[model samples]
Target: MKTDVEKASVAMRELFAATPLQLNEHLSAKYGAQIYLKREDLTPVRSYKIRGAFNFFRKVIASGGSGKTFVCASAGNHAQGFAFVCKHFSVPGVVFMPVTTPQQKIDKTRMFGGEFITIRLIGDIFDQCYAAARDYVEANDGYMVPPFDHADIIEGQATVAAEIAEQLPEGVVPDLVVLPVGGGGLSAGVTGYFRDVLDERAFVFAEPCGAPSLKTSIATGEIVTLPKVDNFVDGAAVARIGDLNFAALKHFAADQVLLLPENAICQTMIEMLNVEGVVLEPAGALSIATLDQLDPQALRDKTVVCVVSGGNFDFERLPDVKERAMRYAGLKKYFILRLPQRPGALRDFLNLLGPDDDIARFEYLKKSARNFGSILIGIETRDRSSFPELLARFEAAGLGFEDITENEILANLII
Candidate 1:
């Protein structure tokens, strides 16, 4: 498998060169470790996904390529990769993407393939989209280019491990390899390669809290389908682990995987953007987000590599990403406040806020009664500590308020 991966890596040179493996000083300083970012985000499609697509196409085209069609379903990155490969091969392909996929990804996929591929918007999630693609393939007698889960796809992804091995400084060894998990292809491929070639293998897998298919399946020794998957980390939010993928990863203990909150992942994304000028999609930020969760002693002075999976973030979502980040860091909050229906009442509430507190949103829900009115208020503060001080003042002033920042139903409806 490692040799196959190496061969694929060599063949891939005909497409794009190796993605950079750079030492991230900002993350290294914060984690107290020698941290490096395996920058899969720098590939032609701004993701490592192109490797798998290209390899799959190369082998398939070599065998036969008369009138067969190719089809694939993806959340975003895979679609772009498949599209790029379709254009490279001049083969007719169709890509199915989640309807909820960011417009940037959908547009890029179309641009990459040009006349070679057709983009189809389907279903609400990858699993549903994949089912639709499978049905299409069956009905049309077309070939399916799986985003992950195939032996060829895994072999292609393993080339990342091959590149990492070649790029690391001579005589340097990584104490830990952090992988972001979606459908488990990258993790399985990379880990399988490491296990085969490296004497000492250490890995930490990160997955969205809302989607823990790998962790759940590993624990049960069987694949388990999730009841619900949060699509916030759309790139990594998979409902079920692939059977082939699970088989490659089953040897590892369940606890080796970390379930990261979506908000925390957003926070990491913002930090990387602001502090390092590195833009990352939610799933791309997963590996880096797990740094603070590790034992400080475990990371101190050790070498770590975080695979930055993709950077195809849509800037239009920046405000929402910042909002989630601020809420996670306690620097911003939303609440419903009850105030007397008087001109002076608004002034009184304003006075209760500390100097650092700024009203981000103010809206009056219909006046509940004659004397009292419900005001939906959102506050942004420079410091997290400001919230406690402001809350204390509100309590002393007898201002009744309900914190709705974490209220999913209410927050989604209004804020």
Candidate 2:
């Protein structure tokens, strides 16, 4: 398997060169460790998925399946890779993407595949789209290039492990390797290739808290499908871990997987963009986010490598990202305040705000209420500690308010 991965990596030169595994000084200093980032984002398709797709296509053609039509379902990154491979191999293909997939991904897939592939927008979530793709494959006699699960796909993604092994600084042995998990292809491939060199305990997997398929499955010792999933982390929010991929990962305990919150991941994304000038999608930022969840003492003076899985970030989502980041940092909050329906009431509430407090939103829900009216308010402050003080001031001033920042249903409806 290791030899096959090396050969695949070498043959991959026809597509693109090996992505750099450069040390990240900012993260290294902060974590008190030598933190290296495997920049899979630098690929032509802006992700490591292309490696698997290229290998899958190459093997299919070599096996005398050149006339077959390929089909796949992906929320984003994998579709882009598959599209690129279809264009390169000059094979006809079809891509099925969820209707809710980001417009940036849809555009990129279309651009890369051009006339070689047809994209069908179906359903609103990945599972639904996947079902459609599977049906299409059976109906059309098309080969399915799964986003993860198959041996060829896993072998292709294992190239990342191969590259990291060869690219490490001389005489340096990594203490930990962090990887992001979606469908388990990348994590399975990476760990398989590193089985001889690294202890299984040295590997840590990160999954979105909203989508804990791999973590949940590993805990139950079976492939458990999630009943509901948050689509925020589009690339990594898989419903279930792939069967073959789970076989490779089942030996590890659930503790090996870190469940990251979507909001916290957003904070990491914003920090990376603002501090390091690095752009990453929610899924891509998972490995880096794992640093915050670790014991600092454990990472002290150790060498850690974070696999930055992808960088197909959509700039148009910056505002949403910033909103989530602020909430996660406790610097911004929303509330439904019951304000006295009088001229002096508004003035009183405004006077209660601290010097650093700024009103991001203020909307009266019932303007004509007799004595009290509900107002949806959003407040932003420089310090998170300031919110407690401001809330205290509200109480002392006899103002009635409810914090809706953490109330998903209310915030979604009113704010």
Candidate 3:
């Protein structure tokens, strides 16, 4: 662990130096808490993943492990970080990514590794890619570099904590530390180091609401696999937490684990982008989103550190991000309305809408009906309260409608 930390610190110097420990005034004022962001997003790979990857390789090479053949399975930041490490160490790495992985991620991974790495798109999901990577590693007798769930990886991730400790004002320990959990390497590493070095600080673990592996593990006293997961917050949506990480995190209170709704996280992402000009992946925003749930009075004047996990967000996803943010903030909604089949029916319904309401989408589900037709309407409003007023108007006018915004089954098929 000591060696890995030392090597990670050294490797970081060779890259673009240290990521900034930036004080974010926008968040500080909003929460009434002194907030600072550990900008892992500014890392060379736009994530802290490189720290762990470099440490893993450095330790292996120092231990006489062959640098010629290394294997890993990741389609996201991990692959890019591993590729960067391979190039830095002059090692040959075979990276397996899911076939459905985005082209942007694939290109970034390749660009980081250059000629030192070979990427293979294996299967549709990460599990399949992981299995394929294991097979290759076993067959070729190559070293398997796990994305997380390894001592070296955890040790390398601890460097973030070390840096934070060093960067803070003298004799100051943050009141709270917020971390986003995927496989939990970063959280485990940071928490482990703090427990050993610092006096006391509350730790809050954030996970995607769709995939609360750490929260579930803490609740059940064992790691449980989620049967299904929403991949919207793809970065931190792990089905299960790492065994080692679970052990370290299991002692925490269940309430300490904050499950952030994927849509709600979008607001934080957009806020950071627009206000701070900071691009954050969904997982990166989890820590910031958790601040909303805290008591403003309790947090006032207290120093808080939130880890901004990664910034590998693809610009192509901007539309979806904006949509989710609006929906979560209640500024946008979708409804299935049974429109009366009358000449003046459309005019009447249109008149009922409030001044703040705008028809974002108006589509006929089926126009063949004579009595009534199902219309899928998406409404955007300047104020969220406008929805209730509009609903009241619809009620007085005897309009039949169903809010399909939160209906998963219907949304899956229609929205």
Candidate 3, residue 308: how far the Cα is off, in Å = 0.3
Q: Which lDDT tens digits does candidate 2 get at residues 285-364?
A: 99999999999999999999999999998888889889999999999999889988778888989999999999999887
Candidate 3 per-residue C-alpha lDDT over 1-415 given as tens digits, one digit per residue, 9 for 90 to 100 = 5445655776767765777888888988888878989999989899999988888888799899864599999989999999998998888999999999999999999999999999999899889999999999889999999888998899889889878887888898898999999999999999888885544348988898999999998899899999988899888889989988888778888988988988889999998899988899998899999998777897899999999999999999998899889999999999989988889989999999888899998998896477998999999999999999999988898899999998879877877
Alpha-carbon RMSD, each predicted model: 1.7, 1.5, 1.6
* Maximum-lDDT candidate: 2
Error of 3 at 318 (Å): 1.3
State candidate 3's TM-score: 0.97
Model 3: how far is 258 from its true place, Å? 0.8
- Check candidate 1 and list the clashing pairs: none
Candidate 1 structure quality by residue, lDDT tens digits, 1-415: 7778899999999899999999999989887999999999999998888988888898988888637889998868888999999998899999988898778778889999999998888888666888999999999999899878898888899899999999999988789999999999999889988995444348999999999999999998899999999988978988898889999998898889999999999999999999999999999999999997899999999999899999989888899999999999999999899999988999888878888899999998888999999999999999999888888888899998999999989988998
Q: Using Cα atoms with residue i matched to residue i, what is each candidate's TM-score against the true structure? A: 0.96, 0.97, 0.97
lDDT of each: 0.90, 0.93, 0.89
**Position 47, candidate 2: lDDT:** 89
**183 Cα displacement, candidate 2 (Å):** 0.3
Q: Estimate the overall C-alpha local distance difference test score of candidate 3.
A: 0.89
Model 1 steric clash total: 0
